[model samples]
Target: MPVSPLLVVTRLLRCLSIGLLLPCVPTGALAQQLASPRDTSFTVHSAYVKAKKQHPDISIARPPVPRGVRAQTKLTYCTPGSRALQLDVFYPKAKRRQQFPAVLLIHGGGWRSGDRSQHVPLAQQLAGRGFVAVTAEYRLSTEAPYPAAVQDLKAAIRWMRANARTYAIDTTRVAVWGFSAGGQLAALIGSTNGNSLFEAGSCHRPHSSAVQAIVDVDGILAFLHPESGEGNDSKSTSAATYWFGSNKLTRPDLWQQASALSYVGAGTPPMLFINSGVDRMHAGRDDMMRQLTALGIYTEVHSFPEAPHPFPLFNPWFQPTLEYTVNFLNKVFPRR
Candidate 1:
């Protein structure tokens, strides 16, 4: 039987589609060959300064209290532009300067948009339960790309530590939590041990930007990936290029360097990844759990039957998701 060339081309396209869809952060240190200087060049404040011109009302919308949650907000960081860069801390108030476990939460906005206010309710709810909650804004790709977002985050970690006393923060037990694009950024901060994505910094900080635990919701596991049947549309792969200064096709190895899973190790923190239904875009959710479990790292993954992306934050406004997140927090920080 002669095989048609047409069939071969069609099959190739299908495989490419699958490749885009199933982007499991390459579970190996394939890009560690270049001993890039331990740096934080990727962190910058100019973009946020430019973005401040278009700021949206500077107010956070909070969810109504269910039972045992208290909320307060305070400015935590500022960019040179004082616009796109800022952070908000939410938590239960202490008598004076008492410390509590903290969760650094990042908001999702395709890497080029979004702000701390978008995540206010989540921050407040977490803080209400005796956990210090932080929502931070970072420079995005339109003005700064790749390491800029991650660098700002690493700076936030450092800032959190430096001011832990004033904020009543438990610097030793902090974790990072994020959704969608923010999730990828959070994981990137966790991975590479705070390696700068670009050559912008020469003098480095002595302390680390590592989080003790991670919670990523519907994040991109790989950079070149665009999900099955999805084009390099603005909603998906374009964000990769905008942030990293290149696309997956042009910079495959760079993509690997940007993923959290590739940096997993014995010292890497435990994880909790949540996925809504098995959309082709998020198939790697299982692969991540599988890899982390194989490494003896404590992990938990959940699938909300029939749910779609963003339910954990914006749906019916989180009934069980709230319970599930708080329960997970309790399990992780029972003493705090």
Candidate 2:
């Protein structure tokens, strides 16, 4: 039986979505594509359009940056060789000499797409509320795999501390907030604080990447947990497969190592899990929270009953999400 050309193109498109452009891809086109960075197809506007289909009235417009807050965009945080990772800082206009607690925001796009701007609204809101909020860009899986994104984020934290005085950031009260894939990174960052394995090649070694708290917005704790939908590569390559550069079966070690549940301990920082209605997205959350609770560490969970996975970027849910985050941060890092 002869396969249709349309079927072949459709198959190739699926692979490209996850950064796998090979096998059926043309030799010349493959070489050209590999020479450049993969496309970041995810964006706040695109997400809003998709979410609006289900909830038509939801507004994507974030409240304007308040008068008390200011923004500094495109500031370089890390320069690994020629590649420069940039971050945007949104902070309260300091009236006195006082420093404010900081939060580093990481955006999510299944590890391959999306950029820092997706979370700018949240960062701005946090800044208006007396926190120095930063939205950071990391090397996506399309550009660099697994540890690269983690390394970029840890570097961003180090950047926060390195420039604490300039930004009026209280380094001692730093926290990380990430959505979806970024959420996974945030949890892993908190869980693996001071772990030497992920510290290689990271700059600002003098400034620690340890975060006092973590806010995971619908991120999975374990990639191989029973509730996880990751690592399934039966048809095209899955996001986990692309990020890890291998399937769960072939790279179980990476899967386990990357799981936040694998590193929970006495020193683990306080964590807040904000989840949507997706059960698979909450994989290992209960077990991880249980472990944290057993160790006497602070852990909390909040769910939006039937909200979308990207609810934090939409209306009705977005306001509540901001409130939950502000409340959590206020509780953990209260003013002196």
Candidate 3:
């Protein structure tokens, strides 16, 4: 019997897999060859740029609900305009009768784009882990500006508390988790609990906006830091400028006032800071951590070396990121 050409090729591939008649390269050497310094640099630069432009589109379909979880979509939390500001709620169907800790998940788009749907997968995962997780929508820079997004987030927290019994959520055990610009809002919400300046919304006003814990995923801590890579140049229309409606030179006070670090004090909640080690977007994270430490607040910081800014949203990094987040929340807002 004669072998077909396809069979011969398959046999060659099998042999190659076993290192037969092939040069055996060291793992380190092979990695080096596949990713030279120059190539790696370019790849990193490209990834950063791509991540910057990536935002959750309203049209993307939501992921299938996990087997043990139930999702409630588009529940109004606030009404700022013609459209109601809504949130998608996720909770374990099996544990729906029992009270659970709640987490508010905020999506990131430099406060210019992105919607609540971006965090549906995360909310679903948290629900599967026995949490009443909510992914919320807020006014963007396109609709409003600066404090408006923060106001919406704070209002969402208050809404959670206002409807705690309805959602089977433990009012005392709640946290806020956000990515990129959303992270900045989460951090600010965590720090400015009783502060009136940022708490401008009318929804759920009687209820407190405080969170028991905070999870900041690569959010800007201090906008003024040199390492921020968000230059202070007044002429450029950076995201910060767009969000603030002015440059640092023109609105230095607003820039400082908007920073999460500026509000960190005795009442600041425990925080977990996760970052791509190389991202300048999280430039002032260390400073914020130090301030929190000095104030005797519990703080944890984790960085994934050589990862991109949007690392947590994708796989490989997402698994570990989820693990870190769940573990931190479990410790901070433990179920009794």
Model 3 ranges with Cα > 4 A deviation = 1-65, 94-97, 231-236
**274 in model 2: Cα distance from truth in Å?**
0.6
Give all candidates' CA lDDT scores: 0.62, 0.86, 0.77
lDDT of 1 by residue, 14-55 (tens): 644554422311112321322223223222133233323444
- Per-residue lDDT of 79-143 in model 2, one digit per residue for the tens? 87667989999999776679999999999999999988998888888988899999999987666
Model 3 C-alpha lDDT per residue in residues 1-336, reported as the tens digit of each score = 333557556754664444231222212433233321211222223444575554322122234566878878989999975549899889875444688999999988777766676677778888988899999988776556678899988999899999888778888999999998889889888988888988884788999988999999989888888778664444545767757765676667888888888888898999999998666768778888898899898999888886667776665577678789999999987677
Deviation in Å, model 3, residue 310 alpha carbon: 0.8
In what order do the candidates fall by TM-score, top score first? 2, 3, 1
Worst 10 residues of 3 by lDDT: 35-44
- Residue 18, model 1, lDDT: 50
What is the alpha-carbon RMSD of candidate 2 to the true structure? 5.5
Best by lDDT: 2
TM-score head-to-head 1 vs 3, winner:
3
